[model samples]
Target: MVNEMKVAFATEEKNGLDSIVSTKFGRVAYFVIVELDNDKKIKDNYIIVNPGGEARSGAAIKAVQKLLEEKVAVVVAGAFGPNALVALDEMNIKHIVLSGVKVSEALGQITDKL
Candidate 1:
């Protein structure tokens, strides 16, 4: 199994070629889980998101909670939604918040911190 103690890095990740393309209007948090012993990673396929609007934080959190059902162990992000936080708490998913950092860079930071 992938490490249960695995950690997820949270950041602002845009799906286009660069960070600017995917999230021009509003930013959404990205999460990636890391395998502790082997240093392997599982990246997201599509964004687990709500309507991608302001004050729609609940959508973000619910999106995350849905992900938790898939057995995600951790969540790394710049910020979070309350629903997501509560769900994470219930599911026991570890969370990390990174501000203004690119997704790849944030992943590196999480790796080092481990």
Candidate 2:
């Protein structure tokens, strides 16, 4: 079967739907990876710990690299640092800013627009 495009969201928790949108992109504790079918239905989801969180400097670049290695087509975060933004743009990864929302709600909004 063909795989659909994958999206990643920086979140505060590990649980799928219950995860909270994190305020900082690079420093976020977890990255929730969600796979969507062509029809925009959620197919699968998982979480990864952000190793860049412990970096004293260059955390944003490291985070972007990690996400790129994951093959994520899009990234959703509350906010991104300048370096991270530039790197994401260079890598052709789409990014969306979303704060004060649950992961489920963000998914709903994204799918609705899709």
Candidate 3:
């Protein structure tokens, strides 16, 4: 089970906090993994390229698997595909969606709500 507070943000670029949040979760070029402390502040961050980002099919499944492998407990994106949503549910991963926001902003909103 996911224990650490790791949040994945779907972004178009490989930037950490500065990356722009991507509207498309499965097709996003990168997933910015941010590690949060107990107080909900960012402790560290990294980027992972999506291998199946441009795939015509099964992209969502692959993306979800990748995030799972990284032990992500939550995901932040502008949107999530149907398949991805199902996969996340099965994996017990929480997700937050925010449109037209930067990765940093999305993180703040999610933490505030929690």
Candidate 4:
């Protein structure tokens, strides 16, 4: 049987796999959720507008909470706020930081590790 997992990418736009990875995790505009099969190939994907992007405070925590609801196994971004990193650690969600890369490239870079 093949194992599958879902990874969420903090993105600057809602352009699916072509979306640029946002530099800031908490204030990102969108979250691209990609499901990967055991072979490290994309099985499915979608996008969600980040509610925490417009928050005045605790945006990182809010973003983490939103991802938790989606049940993502991992998260990818250019950078993670201090609070966001702590939250993700406590929640046991894995995170990868890859700056200035498109969502597709980020996936390619991390495929082997995932």
- TM-scores for all candidates: the values are 0.55, 0.92, 0.90, 0.94
Q: Candidate 3 versus the native: TM-score?
A: 0.90
As a TM-score, model 4 comes out at 0.94
lDDT of 4: 0.89
lDDT, candidate 3, 8-114, per-residue tens: 88888866788888888888899999998777778899999886597888998999999999999988888888888999999999888875677888877778655
The order by descending TM-score is: 4, 2, 3, 1
Per-residue accuracy of model 2 over 4-113 as CA lDDT, tens digit each: 88889898798886798888999888899988998778888999988888889898888889999999988899899999999999999999988778888898877754
Report residue 14 deviation for candidate 2 (angstroms): 1.3
Indicate whether candidate 1 or candidate 4 has the larger lDDT. 4
Return the number of clashes found in candidate 3: 0
Candidate 4 colliding pairs:
none
Q: Judging by lDDT against the true structure, name the best candidate.
A: 4
For residue 60, what is the lDDT in candidate 4?
90
Ranking by lDDT: 4, 2, 3, 1
User: What is each predicted model's overall lDDT from 0 to 1?
Assistant: 0.49, 0.86, 0.85, 0.89
Worst 10 residues of 4 by lDDT: 97-106
Identify the candidate with maximal TM-score: 4
Q: Which one wins by TM-score: 1 or 3?
A: 3
- Model 3, C-alpha of 92: deviation from truth (Å): 0.5
